[model samples]
Target: MSTSAPPDAPPALRARHLRKQFPGVVANEDVSLTLRAGTVHAIVGENGAGKSTLMKLLYGMHRPDSGEIHLDGEPVRFTSPREAIAAGLGMVHQHFMLADNLSVLENVVLGAEPGRAGVLDLPAATRRVEELCANLGVRVHPHAETGGLSVADRQRVEIVKALYRGARILILDEPTAVLVPQEVERLFVSLDRLRTRGLSILFISHKLDEVLAVADDVTVIRRGVTVADSLQANEVSSRELAHLMIGAELVRTERPAHPADQTARRVALGLEEVSLRLSDGRQALDAVCLDVGEGEVVGIAGVEGNGQTELIECAAGLRRPDHGTLTLFGRNITGTTLRRRRADGVALVPEDRHRQALLLEAPVWENRMLGRQSAPPNSRRGWLTRRAARRDTEHLMRDYDVRARDADVAAASLSGGNQQKLVIGRELAAEPKVLLAAHPTRGVDIAAQQQIWRRIEEAAAAGAGVLLVSADLDELLSRSDRLLVMLRGRIVAQVDPRRTSTEELGVAMSGAGESAR
Candidate 1:
């Protein structure tokens, strides 16, 4: 399945014998690859399989212990990211870094200003940004504040920033991990356009369906080495890729068949006329209404930034709705503090794990005690109990399969999957009557995702009402008894997962289908 170019034309980029080692592990070893010109190349691997390390080495974020990189058939050494950019290499990292208060135009041209004099040139930069946006078919406001833009728009701005620097080869890391099906389609279209214009792309993603749909060729990595370097994208399937990543077939848990009666079950959560206006003066939520019954899973599926985050925050008591009444188990909890809501048997697995869920600087045991300081095991009579906390942390580590050296280690030392495991484990340990889960399995490996889903399913089976918010449509369909679609801050449709398809969900998510109630 190898498709290397003929001997006459050189590759757009090439790397040989890359080796990088950390204190306790060999992150990468003897990895070599090639990116043919005017083609989309993909690197696929599970989390902690050295995908990010390899990309960092290529982008000059870290120098390899041993390796060589060549651009246009000539050897080149990039000492810094700036050097890589000057050599026509640009990378959009998985985590976005944008100044919230700054205008989109300012953030785009922050480091790469155009004018020669010391005085800044706003008009020139705006025009250049507008032109780039048009060429890429990305719709974004140049004058709007960065904080007001959606996650998809911010990602487009990041790409426009890279293109403004004259990048001929672009690297995108886990680009579609946060996007819904519709937004993923738009991104694929943009990538295809870039390839048509003769630009080389190196895409990094674990989503195999996207890899097959968007890439011309694929490379699979496992255990810090390239397992298959020349697999043609069209010849591979997601099942095959999963097997390659884990060296075994993926196992799926069987969901229980007992359908809970929506009317007979006790109501665990009730929201009525929930509307929210964001700080930027935009309508984030539009009179949304939903109800979750005990022992039921109600899933909210939509494109990112379609008020999913806002909805979760309002439910978690982090944000106050401009208009709505929130009740838990027939008790009105509107305008209540998060702690009071938590004490009332409410728990949240937030969307942004790093920013919202756990404290990175704390030990694993302390993180396990987070959000539950008012309860027992971690605390007794308003006093923190170290021994009990440590004991429970060890139990969670073993049960949740958090791969850490010890519970005494910092939470920051763990991988993304492990961090997510800790968060889910801690949240579920609270034994809340209602769970608000937002992208709980995002950025995790396939195995980790399975485990998380199993935990959520168990919680729901035990009569815990779950509000599952996810960009993954398959996850929603598999776990949700009922599915609700959100578009432009409004709940546009509701359907049973057993009778719906991803195609129908995609249309409803994009607001192009008939509204179902």
Candidate 2:
């Protein structure tokens, strides 16, 4: 069903026949979308479905190969992001771009400062920023460093930055991917406020429920084509949206094992009374202890900033615990170097793939050869073998179904799902005895998510222990043999995955459930 706008209503933005193509891929093909003032428009699609490509076109990060863009009923073309911003279009990227060492006010006005002379007009900028924050109900510390803020707070700063630039149309890409349930609620509230103030919002997300809850209209894209447009949120169900995006029904598989007592076995990874303090002397991890056995997937579920990151870093030997013992295969490894841990068969797929997993500026083949360049065949006598690395990367790309043009292309050129596939492919090739996967499928499409699940299960079936940390409860419950809830820097409860409900898990993760003895 489509609702016609009022006679006086004008479209905030519209695109016609937008087309973009690379050598081997048609990134966006004759796609079109319309957005009206004060409405939340959502674009849903599988990864590589041209959602990001379409947004880049709209935001002027890339000029459309062939198309027309209209702003306020007039034909307009933008050559760059700055041009788009000047035309009242602003975008908040999935990965934030803020200076970690700078204050929030400074980061917000980094490019557009209010000053007549060389010196910055700090007072004017701060006042305007404070007013913007108040108007949007976005709470951000003006004097606080961007590095010291929480994920949610940092996102708010991004929103405020867009508003500060006089953006009438706002594009948010996967805004809720890193947020917990509570943070998501707050974000939705802010979006609603923006809508009320006659700001047009273009929301791109993989989470169907969030789209349904917040969007006024939904548009579905598949394989670079617009499959459905002007879809009313109330008229469609989540199941139908999933089918439209994935082109098939998603059959959620059950965890392989039933409840059983295998607690007596030698643990593959064990943490005993681990504690960690930050550089500023704040306690990040407090006496945390957990264990994962072979042939098992132990899930760590928590809201962000609940010490999950510190826990993962300590497990991977990237950070040392201030106190306590870390054992891998019954060997003390608390003070071991990261290289030593990796050599001891410890593999980590970090939460931030762009930062920790792959080198963005490097070629796919070079990335595939990382961490194993010292081994035989690929390298000898401190020399690199490009041919061998390329062949291996090509083979792994095919085996993992990474949809990329060539192995020589930069890793950053691939889509989010394909990048994740490359990371997983490279990490799994190590055949580690223990795998630490944090939000492995965070921004991937449904098909890629299924492939990742299969890979994780394959690892577990091969007697490799898995520690899975994610905010996605359905994914956690479906893949993990057992679930451990982390709250306030410690494990609060352990439950059989098959026996827990979403509500119960939420409560446990929030520290409202009975402690596990």
Q: Which digits, one per residue and each the tens of the lDDT, describe model 2 over residues 1-517?
A: 2234465876889888899998777999978888977799999998888999999999888998898999989898888999999999989999998898999998888888888987888899999999989977887879999998988899999999998898999999999988877778889999988888888999999889899999999999998988888699999998898899888998766667834778655699999999999897778888888888987899988888888999999999999999999999889999999889989999889999898989999999988877888775578788888887888899999998887788998988888988998989888988889999999999987778888888878888888889999978888888887788887787778887888987778777777864663
CA shift of 413, model 2, Å? 0.5
Off by over 4 Å in 1: 1-7, 121-124, 253-261, 374-376, 380-388, 513-517
Worst lDDT window (10 residues) for model 1? Answer: 254-263
Q: What's the TM-score of every candidate structure?
A: 0.91, 0.93
Q: Candidate 2 local accuracy as lDDT?
A: 0.88
Worst 10 residues of 2 by lDDT: 1-10
State the lDDT at 146 in candidate 2.
92
lDDT of 1 by residue, 1-517 (tens): 2333456788899988899987666878878888988889999877677888888898888899998999999998877999999999988887887888998899899999888776668799989999989878898999899987878888888999999898989999888988878788989988888888778899988677888999988888887888888688888888998888888899766555554545689989999999999887879999999999998889999888789999999999999999989999989898999998988889999998889998999999999889887677988998988998899899999999987767887888777778999999998988889999998888887877888888888888888999999988888888888889988899988987887888888888877843564
How many clashes (backbone N, Cα, C below 3 Å) per candidate?
0, 0
* Shift of residue 131 alpha carbon in model 1, Å: 3.5
The candidate that wins on lDDT is 2
